[model samples]
Target: MSHTLPTDIRLHKKSRTLELIYGDINYELTAEYLRVHSPSAEVRGHGIGNGVLQTGKQLVGIKGIQPAGNYALKIIFDDGHDSGLFTWEYLLDLCQNHDQHWQDYLQQLQDAGASRNDGMIARG
Candidate 1:
C-alpha cells in the first residue's frame, strides 16, 4: 500500500516537535522521538538484529528540515545528527504507530538498564 505525502510539515521549535499533516490526519512527533528512531545507519545498523539502542535523547531538538529530492525529508537535529532520510511512507508509519513504537522503545531502554536522561543508567 502507498501512503500519501504530508500536505504540510512544520517544526515547532519551542515545543521541539515536528508536525505533519496528511489530509485530515495530523501527527506531532517529538524531537527526542525522532532522534532515537532515526533511520540512519548509526541507529538502524547495517543488518537486521544489530540495531543500536539510543539513550540520553530526552532533550533533543530539531535544528532544521530539508526536502530530499522528492521522496524524503532530511532532518537535522540539535545534537548533530543529520544522516537520516525520512521517507514519506516511513513518516506516515511512524505517525500511525507512534504509541506502540514509543512503548517498545521504553521497554527496550528498561531492559537495557538505560535512562532517557544523559549519563545515567539505572540498575535493576
Candidate 2:
C-alpha cells in the first residue's frame, strides 16, 4: 500500500507539534519520533530485510516538516538528520505501529547498553 502526506498539514504553533491529516485520520508527529525513526532509505534500507535500528533520540525534537513534492516530506530533526524523505504510507504505518515501534527502539537501546536519555548508542 502506498500513502502520501496530505497537502493540508496543520501545525500547532505553541507546542511546535504537527498534524498530518489525510481524509479522516490525523497523524500527530513529534520531533523526537520523526528524528529517531526517519523513514528514509538510510533508516529503513531498501528491502524487507534492511532496517537499521536507531537509538539515542529520546530528546531529539522535530524542527519542522517540509513538503517534498506531492509524495513525501522532508523532516528536519533537532539532531540534524535532514536528508530523509518520509512518504505518506510510511508515516501512516508509523502512526499505526507507534507503540510497538517505540518499544522496539527502546529495547534496541537497552540491548546496546545505550541510553536515549544519556547519549549512547550501538558501536556498529
lDDT scores in order: 0.92, 0.72
TM-score against native, each model: 0.95, 0.74
For candidate 1, give the lDDT: 0.92
Off by over 4 Å in 2: 1-7, 13-16, 41-52, 121-124
Report backbone clashes per prediction. Answer: 0, 3
lDDT of 2 by residue, 2-107 (tens): 3454646776635656687777887776666766688777777898869676666666667777878767778777677888987777777777888987788777
> Which candidate number has the best TM-score?
1
lDDT at residue 4 of model 2 (Cα atoms): 56
RMSD in angstroms, all models?
1.4, 3.7
Range of the 10 consecutive residues with the lowest summed lDDT in candidate 2: 1-10
Candidate 1 stretches with Cα past 4 Å from truth are 1-3
Best by lDDT: 1
Q: Cα lDDT for residue 110, model 1?
A: 90
- The sequence of per-residue lDDT tens digits that candidate 1 reaches over residues 1-124 is 3356998999999999999998888899999999999999999999998899999999989999999988899999999999999988889889999999999999999988998988378875
